[model samples]
Target: MSSAFSLSSGRGRGAARLAAAALVWGLATAGTIAAAGTATADEIPQNQGGATATIGDLKTYGSAVIHENGEDSWVSAGLFEMSVENGGMLQTYGVDLHSPTQRDARYQETSWNGTSLSGNAKAGRIRWILENSYPQVNDLAALAGKAGVTGLTEQDAAAGTQVAIWRYSDGADVDAAAPQAQKLADYLEKNARDLAEPEVSLTLAPAAVSGRPGERLGPVTVHTNAGSVTVTPPTDIAAGGVRVVDQDGRAVTSATNGSRLFFDVPAEGADGSTSLTVQASTTVPVGRAFTSETHSQTQILAGSSESTVSAAASANWAAKGAITALAAQKNCAKGGVDITAANKGDAAFTFELMGDEHTVAAGVSETLTIPLQEDQVYDFTIGGADGGGKRFKGVLDCKTQGGASGIAAQTLSEPSPASVGGSDGGTDLAETGGSGLTPVIAGAAIALVLVGGAVVVLVGRKQTPPQV
Candidate 1:
């Protein structure tokens, strides 16, 4: 998403710029895990006492500009461009300014491009122009006194060309004074023919955010930090989706483009502070099982710093099981058999019993007394539709009361087939059976057969007695 904020000129501009620079540096440094080192200064070159040094008296005028160029995922280069008007001045005196240090400790030198020098400098480093005129120790001392600056010292007072140096343990001090120093440098460079400083412009790198991965099957939230800015909806936030609100719970206006969310916060508060709120949201498909995911990325806010935040969301769906019971009444006062069907799942179902169709809504139980002949079996079909448009079909074998009858209930523990007219394809059934007389009659028949076999064996033995 594209978001822009206005950086009001004046005092706020400097603070906003500095904050932005800090933000860029923080983002760049966050990826590098190394031992911190103390700042040390390199020895300055000394002028050897010799014959009157012949300093080139060439007049010079030029402009220096700085640009920000991103080089990789974790690094960006700040480039400086210098353009001089006179060719002779280029050979006489080169520009001297402190620049940012690169990831590599070696200082990068500017290459000549048709009388113009341009090269990459360290990101977020402040560069200051030093005096390059000869025999100006008295003038340098006076200027330092006027400016109330204490770091200035003349490096070579007797050389034909004067060189002044400012000893700094680190770039932090220079950065603190960069805004005011820039104004002075701009003015002097514009008017002074013998001295010049480059005009510097900084572009901060975009905030690198760690985005959630996998499929976020529902509403998901993503967050990151932008220096002093605090991100809400911490990592692994599951509910309420993603949203940005002020202290009063007032929603901040925002727009989302694809996976990126863009919003603006005031560059500075009424008290000259920086504060803003932002929220982002996206929808993902949920599956049958629970799915957990994380989102990470880098975001760049206009006129602000880059921040990286990661959030997690878990997508879950309920696994439903139908609670069903089949009740049968045999030899009722007036009916063949009473059948009842109950549904406890969150879905309505349709059932067919003894050629009668019935509808059973979710969490409801329906009972119907149907007349059927004794010892006769009938097809009792039940079907229903779930929330996902899937169909379920079940069948029960219903028989009227044969001998003795009472109420009986059967519980179903499995899901029905997902098609109409589909049999259970199993022998398990819930039904009332005939009386106990069937077993007794079968026993009597077995006894009669045994007696007949004994009588036949005795007659055969009597007929064969003479042969023995």
Candidate 2:
């Protein structure tokens, strides 16, 4: 992705610097960097400064009784706030509720600040009190008499549900409560189920292309088949010099995180076809460059079966030529020298003008206009198949005309006559000096050696003809 803001010229430099400074200042003030808002279960951040924090969405679970006539439910409330403070201190806070609904639920807020929990002592105390006292003490008067707490019990009675608060001063006291807290947290997590959300699937149409090296192929059309959802175009899709463009011939931004391209889907379902364009870079060679997308059904529920489908499109390059020619005035002053090179051959060939080299295909021509100094000399070289599978090489040397507006043109020709050899009129044999008879003599020598060895073997096995 390109920069969100460009400081290409000096005009925007000051504004860019100010924006960066403001961003840093905002982060420093926030104390913690979080995603935009309160994160969902899957989006919660974890492992902050050696302490882990997890937040689960509130959901109703198992039922219980608080009053004599009214039924109450137990909701395991896990840690809502947990942090590792400076100097290796750990702090945690949580709230548990027992009632059928939030309006009538009895809640207790508890906090602990310490190094570690001791054993199950505090957890046992809490569990025992809730199991033994809560069911029997149906009224506020009985609950206060049992716990020996007066004002808090009266307040809970007025509110119609009990409320308890606890804070541990010593590390050992906090340690005793850890096991029960963990148990409650686990229970809540196990009971909570995710709500279902709409699913979206994406499909990319197949693309095939054949072009010569150094030839730009596209804007090739790409169609997107979206499943029951409105899908947006990818933000960026340039990978390995391959570019994606829109219908207007403008490039579309795309991320390169993986072969799978992700596009935003609107809440309302997208069921129609969307089209884009893909272009292959000129430098791509004779082969296939493929871009793929794998789409999976989005699941809102935990432990749901996931299904994925993948599709790929390829840009194929072949042995062909693409060339161009143009002439223009340079600097609106000097008359430029326009040189054109056309590939009259059947296949792609490499053309070198001066020191620059380009690949040209059959029936294609390339023209270059060079700002010239009078009498300047330039050289050219062309090599590859010409026609009927015959390979050829051509070279040219020309000088610019001595005056402005003067044109000097010449057709390129083979600097040397073709000799009988390979298709390119060039032999693949290594320069070993001796004539082609070298391999023949070597083969004969090897044959004689083999025959002599065979004879020796026969004589050794004869044993004076054995039977005479």
TM-score result, candidate 1: 0.16
Backbone clashes in model 1 = 22
Question: What tens digits encode model 2's per-residue C-alpha lDDT throughout 112-195?
Answer: 110011121242233222322222234645554443444423213211111111111011101111232223322322332322
Residue 214 displacement (Å), model 1: 27
Candidate 1 residue-wise lDDT, 1-468, digit = tens: 111222222121111211223222110000110111112211111111001111111122111112112110000111111111111101112221211111111111111110112121221111222232212224755544444444433321111110111111111111111232333333323333321222111110111111111111222222222112223432222222333333334443432222232222222211100112222221110000000000000000001111121222211111233333333333224323444555444555454433344666766767666553222222222322211111111111111111121111111111111100101111122111111111111112211111111110000000010110
- What TM-score should be assigned to candidate 2? 0.15
Q: What lDDT does model 1 reach? A: 0.21
* lDDT score, candidate 2, position 165: 12
**TM-score: which candidate is best?**
1
